[model samples]
Target: MSSPGFKADAAAMTRAVQGFEECAANAKKTMSDLENDLVSALSHYQGSQATAFWQLHTQLQDKMRVASSELDTMSNLVNQSFHNYGSGDSTVAQSLTSLSNNVDAGGAVFGRLTGA
Candidate 1:
C-alpha cells in the first residue's frame, strides 16, 4: 500500500519548488531594476569616466540578462516537474505501482509453495 503521507510529501515538495521559482523571479526583477537605475546613472556623465563606466555597466548588464534567462528556464522546468508530481501519474508513481504488483505476485507464489 502506498503511504498516506506520499501525497503530503509531494505537495510539500511542489510548494518548495514554487518557492524557488518565486525567489528567482524576485531576484530577476530586482536585477532588472538595478540595471535600469545604472543605465539612468550612465546617461548623466561625461568624458573618459563615462566611457569606462558604460563599459563596466554593459558587461554587468549582459551577465544579468543571462542570469535572468537561466532563472526563467529553471521556472519552466520546475513547473513541468511539479505538474507531473500532482497528477499521481508520474514515472515515480508508475514505478511504485509496478513494485507493489511484483511484491504481491511474489507473496502469492510463496504462499502456494508453503501450502497456505
Candidate 2:
C-alpha cells in the first residue's frame, strides 16, 4: 500500500529517467549525423582536389578528434558528478563546474576549426 506522496514521487522519478534517456539518444543521433556528413564530404573530393582535401580533412579530423575526446571526458565527468550527487558528495558541484569550463574550451576550439 503506497501513500499518495509516494506515488507522486515515483512518477517524478520516471519522468526524470525518461528525459535523461531522450537526451542521451538525441546526443547519439547528432554525433552519428556529424560523422556521416564528414564522410560524405570526403567522398565527394577526388583526384587533385583530393590532395588539398586530404590536408584540410586531416587537420579538421585532428581537431574534431581532440574535441571529441574532450567532450567524452567532460561527459564522464558529468556522469561522475551525478553519481557523486546521488552519494551526497559536495565535490560533485565543483566537478560540474569544471566540466562546464572544459566543454566551453572545447567548443571554442571546435569553433575555430570550423571557422564559425
Candidate 3:
C-alpha cells in the first residue's frame, strides 16, 4: 500500500481543542446550576431514608467539585499544549515559562480548586 499523502491540520486541531475547553467550562456552570436545583429539591424530602440519602449526596459534593475542577484544569492545560505544538514554534523560551506556569497550575488544581 502506498503511504497516505495527508497531514493533520494543526490550526484546526487547536481551534477544536480550544472550543472544547470553552464548552467544558460552560458545561461545568450548567452542571452547578442543576446540582443546586437538585439540592434545593432534596431539602423538601420528608422521610428519614430520604434525608439520609440527601446527606450522603451532600457529603459527595466536595468530591464532585474536585472532579469538575480537575476536568476544567486538564482541559485548559491540553488546550495550551495543543496551541504550543500546533504553532510549531519552539524557539520562544519566554513563552515556555508561561506554558510551564499553566502546567503547574493544572497540577495544583488537582489537589484543590482555585479562583479562575
TM-score of each: 0.69, 0.45, 0.55
Candidate 2 residue-wise lDDT at 68: 62
Give a tens-digit lDDT track for model 2, residues 77-115: 656655544444235556888999887889978788889
Better of 1 and 2 by lDDT: 1
Computed on alpha carbons, the lDDT of every model, listed in order, comes to: 0.84, 0.67, 0.71
The TM-score of predicted model 1 comes to 0.69
Provide backbone clash counts, one per model: 0, 0, 0
Per-residue lDDT for 24-78 in model 3, tens only?
A: 8887887788788878778787799678868877776877788798887889788
Q: What is the C-alpha local distance difference test score of candidate 1? A: 0.84
Query: When superposed on Cα atoms, how far off is each prediction in RMSD?
Result: 3.7, 21.1, 18.1
Instruction: Specify the poorest-scoring 10-residue window by lDDT in model 2.
Output: 84-93
- As a TM-score, model 3 comes out at 0.55
Q: Candidate 2: where are CA atoms >4 Å away?
A: 1-32, 89-116
Off by over 4 Å in 3: 1-8, 90-116
Candidate 1 vs candidate 3: which has greater lDDT?
1
Tens digits of per-residue lDDT for model 1 on 12-76? 87788979978997898899899889989998988998999999998998899899889889888
> Which residue pairs show backbone clashes in model 3?
none
